[model samples]
Target: MTHTFEPEANKPGTQAGPIPEAAQETLPVVYQDEHLVVINKPTGLLVHRSPIDRHETRFAVQLLRDQLGQHVYPVHRLDKPTSGLLVFALNGDVARALSEKFNDKTIKKQYLALCRGYMPSQRLDYALSVKLDRIADKHKQQDKAAQPAITDFTTLATCELPYAVDRYPVSRYSLVLCEPHTGRKHQIRRHLKHAGHPIIGDAKHGKSVHNRFFANTFQADHLLLSAVGLDFSHPVTGTRLTLNCAAAPKFIQAIKRIDWQEPDWAVAIAPKWLAHG
Candidate 1:
């Protein structure tokens, strides 16, 4: 995780996304204690500033720090366009402890996504090339072999739109549950694209025609990918913890437009642990 303490030199929070400055307090907290703070991050907000997106000024770390009036350490990252549960540590020690869990693959994560075309319940065990940011990893990174990536997916619902999309008379979509076995940058989005069912509203690794259709019809300009649930054992107490976050409003809106029934995996309006964070 990267953070700049140069508050006087630059004001990150002052620059804004579509989310109003007043709505910053409304950011949902999913889990919290002396050691950890987990939040339901909104779409288009960066996990932290990156050289890849120099113009982006709104970030989760900055918002949370200002909201809590203290320093919070990022334990893991959720892509800027992806929303849902994100965890942060209260201090460096806790951050290291939690980061170890993520590195070891002991942390289990589940994501909900809306995709184009039909996808059956199957495990996608595919290899993906390294996706580098033009600014961040441009010349410093080595050209390595494709990494192994696996995502277990189950189709929860399907929709066939009346309008002709591309070649087909009717557009097909699916509500997919994704559990990625490996953590790579854009793993889920790229894997879904490779499987021929790229996520809806994904400007990257997705079909532009389908993306424009969602923007025109459903008013969804953000990617339809959400981290719905996370499970891990606490580093201090060693107790098993299960944290779930509800999907973004636009995601729910898009699913509803397709008449998708809420599957068991979809989280509720409020999970029990929300108030604590």
Candidate 2:
């Protein structure tokens, strides 16, 4: 789905406007120099075009391109529902170098997820090596086209909502730090689903009952995934670089619903080994 670049918003020097309220001046620049640019991307924005979403005209790539007035090539993708630090390169050399970090798994990316059930106080160990069952609809199961996926999650805090379920008491919530060893489409979502504790507001892998509760209670309409931190080598300087972005507003709002404080782990928790690598 290719959206035509429309230079509509006129700000004297720049073109493109009537910016959506969500797309207002919230693009926080974490790090930017001659080589690369990294910023906290807002959720509900597409990174690029795909066969699925054709009407999406305003994307991270296009928005940044217009903001910078030069081509900013995307180095990685954050699912439309996921928001956090996203990297882009100003030139092909930087793009290639940064791509290598991701391809070799040298870059460490960490996310904060709010799950439906109580995540074990102890570290949750699980491997999601499930076959990719690509079906036309999510309700039906297709043949297993397996892929190796692994996720490590640790519970930061847990709480019970005031609302009640059918027979059970109030529902539970867990704030978890997720480290994805592999970047598959919806890997974290699926892994948490396989673990029997899907992330809240996950339309594809989560339960509708919990989603409705979050929306009605917390006003959350998107998935609860935030790319809280990332570490990689500077493409231009070849020096170790680390950047972190705060959890999205919706994430903060949801946490308020459970009456919990953001823990120290909510800060960047990538492995120390990546700094040496």
Candidate 3:
């Protein structure tokens, strides 16, 4: 089964009038087919409704559903502040099959992150206890064993800025490509933090001095992490599918301001995708 990209407003016999509030927001469609749809979700948009952000009026799921005029099932999630490729299954059976692939660790995911300090290519094998939310995980167990988590990181580029954001007179940062073998919550951010190179805008696991410096200097306020690529087999057809997208505009602008070049692989994936606003 194959599906084409057609918004509800463009459908036949649909009356045109004042657009509803939900239709106002549009998520960038990266890839769409009969069984799955991928979107380059913007930063600060939740995958779905959550108690953590009760006041957020808009979400990716809601907006995408409104745009497609059909229900979408999210197979995975990105943090509220992280932006990049997000996949959604169009139906329940496909959603379950994709979820199983994710559960079995068959899906290969790649992320780009701007982190504090220069980092080297390395594989981090760590164990992380569940980071439960007070309101959201209220009914969950208080104590759980740490789960095994592993991530492979490669330093794409590095830059040193002449500013005293922290104790050092010159602050250094790196453009990192992260591939996590496990899907633990906040795994990349936490692993990078553990390695002493937390992502630039990670308020929970990063340094405030650098975060503030970037915000004040470059006006980049969102997390520097982006889910840039995903490689997996099509749930319906056994063919492999590779989906890639560029980071948010703010993220690209920050890289430009810092004079850091994106990796060749990232550029090759989407040449014009890095065109910053």
Candidate 4:
């Protein structure tokens, strides 16, 4: 493995701003500088095109590049159904530096999710098979061994909704904070499923009954997963930067149904980024 990291210097006279609520309809800039630009990617938007979905024309890479009037290099990828902070480098050198950080597991990320069943706080230790693509990895080993994957989960709250979502009359759920130790494709979602508490609205690895329940009841057509916070050293400045973004409105509505103290949850446990807003 190579370990070369050097970020490009920023040019003066260019200004970047955070994503405002009004701009949520489009790609919202969470943080931006001359070297790097971060966006709050909405659910259902691909980070880039993949053989998994060949028909997608509007992707984060294309949308952000056009939105900013410049080319952007994607440092990492978030699943199309996942929403949260996405980082893009204005240039290639910076992109390489940031990508190295992600590979080395130096970039800290926290995700918020609603799960199907009541789960206590626990560390999920498991491995996942690499999800191969139809076109890209067609020749790769179809029966390749599983790769190491781990995730830490803490239950922030739990509740029983008055709806028959499963075999039971009342549906059970938990709001969990998921921190993945690896960046394997669909790591968090897959790990949670292996632990028998799949994320709500995860159509592929989740329970279809609960997914339909959320869709019909809450109008939640996408995964109820959000990258709520990220902490990493800036590629250019080397400053430790912490950023956080709230989940989609429908997620909050589901949380409210659990009777979790939303305001207390924010003030006591949320990062300063959300508090500052």
Which candidate's TM-score is highest? 3
- The local lDDT score (0 to 100) that residue 30 gets in candidate 2 is 62
- On residues 1-277, what C-alpha lDDT tens digit does candidate 4 reach at each position? 1111112333322226764432233476667879998777778888987887888876888767656768899999898889888889999999999999999999889898988788778988788888998787898889879898889998876767788777788888888889998999999899888888999999889999999888888777679998878889999888888777667657766555555534465444464223211
Badly placed stretches (over 4 Å) of model 2 are 1-26, 121-145, 261-277
Q: What TM-score, to 2 decimals, does candidate 3 have?
A: 0.90
lDDT of 3 by residue, 1-277 (tens): 2222222332211226877866776777867778988888889999999999999988988888877878899999999999988889999999999999999999999898989998988999999989999999999998999999999998888888889889988899998889999999999999999999999999999989999998899889879898888888899988888777777788888876666545443553344436445
lDDT of 1 by residue, 27-130 (tens): 56767778898888888889988988888877888788766657889999999899888999999999999999998899989898999988888998999888
Score every model by TM-score.
0.85, 0.79, 0.90, 0.85
Better of 3 and 4 by TM-score: 3
**Model 2, 1-277: lDDT tens per residue?**
1111111342211546575553354355666677788877888878877546766776888777767667888988998889888999999988998888888888888888989777764333454444443442345565555656667787877776667843467778888888887777688888888788899889999988888888887888789888877866676676777676666677666665566534543343333211211
Report residue 117 deviation for candidate 2 (angstroms).
0.9
Candidate 4's error at 110, in angstroms?
0.5
Per-model lDDT: 0.79, 0.71, 0.84, 0.78
Off by over 4 Å in 4: 1-25, 139-143, 261-277
Candidate 4 positional error at 135, Å: 2.5
Which candidate leads the pack in lDDT? 3
